[model samples]
Target: MTDTLLPESDAGNTSDAVHEDRLWCDNGWTARVIKNEDDDGWAVEMIKDGEAEPALVGPWTMGRDKKNPKPLDIGAFNTLVKTASEVLRRHEQQLHAQLHKRLTVESGDGSVEVTLDIVPDEDDPYALLTAFDALGEQLAQVKVAPNFKLSRAGAASWVENGFRRPG
Candidate 1:
């Protein structure tokens, strides 16, 4: 497939560097200002290298002529890269939180730490329910459905039930 590259501006420097009027490629990312298809205004998209889709897209400021988009400068490109990188970082953090969990509950024996670590397999998604004694000795571990709702009452009940696989 033929790739359509934006015209290089006079600011173009080294082979790996591209500082153009409406396009920039640097720091493993590319920022491009394009006419918004949903509206008459323009939009800016920040895409990481080798990614088919942009990581971030937002409205672009208008130029002095009002009809044209403002040039993509070094400062703007840096800000876009920061914002897009932050977006990806936050997304990864959220996914991690969803896959791992820990909770502490008071059982008749003592305080037990419970954990649920989900394995997001394409065909066999499941979670491991584990219990540990206050001294850090693993009490039991069982494979449960990924959607199992771990709660204080559920954990206490499981501990009280002798740590058999939660049915």
Candidate 2:
């Protein structure tokens, strides 16, 4: 894509500075101009690399600096896009790690399967634990606290209770 250059003002350096001709930086995010197929003015889109999609999108005002905005440009838009993408990538990774966890332990009777499922919450992390029979039948399910470490004694006890304990 062709990059548009913004006219320099009293803002700062032009080399590393993000050109405000087309976009601006707010809170370390890059905002750009996109067609607002629905309305007038323009639709501002916040892009963060690695994120599934844009972090934010809304109507934006132009030349609103001091009195109004100047314009949008390439350098400024690129910077904001990179920052927003990083933020999104981190959030996505965190969710993935919390939602899926699997562990397997061998026992005297058979094998104990331990899985930790992270439930998203605004308060604290929550998880679920399930015990399965050797045949993969669901035996029991319990609500487990976040970061709960599986204990060997518990697995051993479950096996002992189900079958003969080794002497």
Candidate 3:
């Protein structure tokens, strides 16, 4: 078979997709068709480059012979890439929401923004509780447990207590 060349932008993208019968790679994603472990069918796995786990995996259609898996083509590969990219995006948004939180509360002086940023360290997981005034000037910051809950009542209490460490 003739060797296919990628565009200039994708030429620099190493480990890219190559169109094949059961495998396709491009757009920073790889799609591989394999036998479904749970049944006598085929499955497609889409994995983003540099990621250890596949972003998406689902059943694949059978070929005309009705025994073998369908071949990977440009249209199918593009669709797989789009679906996998969406999965990664949603995952990142979820992780960010889990690791960071913010709340604004009214204090004696004015409104204060309280934020909790969690650091998921393997050995020493922790979170930082920070207070900022209306002018965006930092009022106080302290290390707290990663599970620190940032709520309106909690933030108001912290600001009222002179930004002391939450108990």
Candidate 4:
């Protein structure tokens, strides 16, 4: 049954819902409604793309109106799916980005190359840029502060000017 939008509670009991429809997400995860066969409960299984098993499994319930959930509607279901997907996506993305990440930049003279390895620091969640030569010798290393952002040219200039740290 997919005619209604499951309330936050029902969304929690994804295993009991009958005829569960799967919600596709842009963040490389798939959410599916499944009857919790063991307990006859409603539940949702969120699985990562290309993975055989679900990354998360939770229960889903019907909306407060107690509408029969069947024949999932594309519009309403999409919105719910999108919201949930985004949260998972953000979490996965942040986790990955927190791991050892590198940003490389080539020097104007081609004599040096800069590799930025971003590490998460509670006090300063930024990266450290290690400038190295083609010969694989470290040249310069600087800590990119938490307030640092390279997306904005003004921010970059600020870092270059000593007003901020390059991130």
Clashes of each: 0, 18, 3, 30
Candidate 4 per-residue C-alpha lDDT over 58-162 given as tens digits, one digit per residue, 9 for 90 to 100 = 666654555432333445344556666676788789887755444434444344444446676677577765555678777567777644444434333433454
Q: Rate the local accuracy (lDDT) of all candidates.
A: 0.87, 0.59, 0.87, 0.54
Candidate 1: misplaced stretches above 4 Å? 1-15
For model 2, give the 10-residue run with minimal summed lDDT: 10-19
Candidate number with the higher lDDT (2 or 3):
3
Kindly provide the TM-score of model 1 when superposed on the true structure, using C-alpha atoms.
Answer: 0.83
Error of 3 at 130 (Å): 0.7
Candidate 1 least-lDDT 10 residues: 1-10
Cα RMSD of all models vs. native, in order, equals 5.8, 12.0, 2.2, 11.7
Any runs in candidate 2 off by more than 4 Å, and if so which?
1-83, 120-126, 132-137, 151-167
Model 2 agreement with the true structure over 86-158: per-residue lDDT tens digits: 7778988988876766555677657767566767677986777666667887666667666665556654564
